[model samples]
Target: MSCLVSSTCSLVPFDSSLNRPSRSSKLGSSISWQSSFPRLSIEIGPVISSPIVKKESFVQAAWTRRSRGEAAKRPNKKSWKQRTDMYMRPFLLNVFFSRKFIHAKVMHRPTSKVISVATTNARDIRTNIPSLVDDEACRLIGKLIAERSKEADVYAVSYEPRKGERIEGKLGIVIDTIKEHGIIFVP
Candidate 1:
């Protein structure tokens, strides 16, 4: 019979009859030496060894996947924010576009607070811009947000497009306008 110490331990065989204790032969002792525990023998197995390597960060993994033509494997909005929060700057500039209006906000991620905001529905923008929603309106909103962000001391911003929105066309114009107004866009 054998006893297990750990999962990877090897089995060891022993002759049970030779190690059994006698009941009659006893010295004048208060406590008995014989006990119920079974005697066991162990044979150590060979040591196992394996190589270890450091794992890549989420952002690096994402870039690698992109380079491999696996665009669909990119992280979603929630995970992207969580990963970026670890290493990138704490300030984030978020832009949202809708059917009738475009909205932009500069947010401090660490404190979860908005630094500045601008939208087509604002009083000054509505009064100055003729159309509420269009390429021109998008540019105006971008410029307004950049100016306001500067007032709040935020010079750099990250653009987070929605699920399938491409960074071109009207969206491209908005981003260019923000950059022209002296705000940096984090890639």
Candidate 2:
């Protein structure tokens, strides 16, 4: 019989045969307690040690098998939002000190352009307003917009030029507007 003290400690009935000193007649005091009782010296053989297997009670094993069977019966993939919410909702709630929620809005203008807005707060407006017409700013803003779109599902709509309209000129104007007002309407 054995009594487990904790996960790392256990007490087992000392085996008399193994505990018997090889040379009992030798009365040398140099030998330590380990040498006196060799059976008490644990010989952990090459065995795979797993916490699940170590502490698994009968009830736990039964419940685990039942859960596994139920999971096998219905296997489904989770959406990006659902997965994100499941992992990050608690963290976001703790950070924001409120319940977390996501709202998405897809707006279609009279022109062919389409604008999308997504945020937890309705008042938060993120416009892809270009800070500068320079190549560096354009690249940085492009990357930022792409990242924001993926995170919040907000797509910035760009206008399609008509026949004979200078695309570069319109782009310059848009950049100027963004630099001045920090936002510009699609089309």
Which is the leading candidate under TM-score?
1
List runs of model 1 lying over 4 Å from the truth: 1-87
Q: What is the lDDT of residue 33 in candidate 2?
A: 54
- Worst 10-residue lDDT window, candidate 1: 50-59
Q: Which candidate comes out best when scored by lDDT?
A: 1
TM-score of 2: 0.20
lDDT of each: 0.69, 0.36
Candidate 2, which ten residues in sequence have the lowest lDDT sum? 89-98
Candidate 1 local distance difference test against the native: 0.69
RMSD (CA, Å), each prediction? 15.0, 19.3
Q: Model 1, residue 22: what's the lDDT?
A: 26
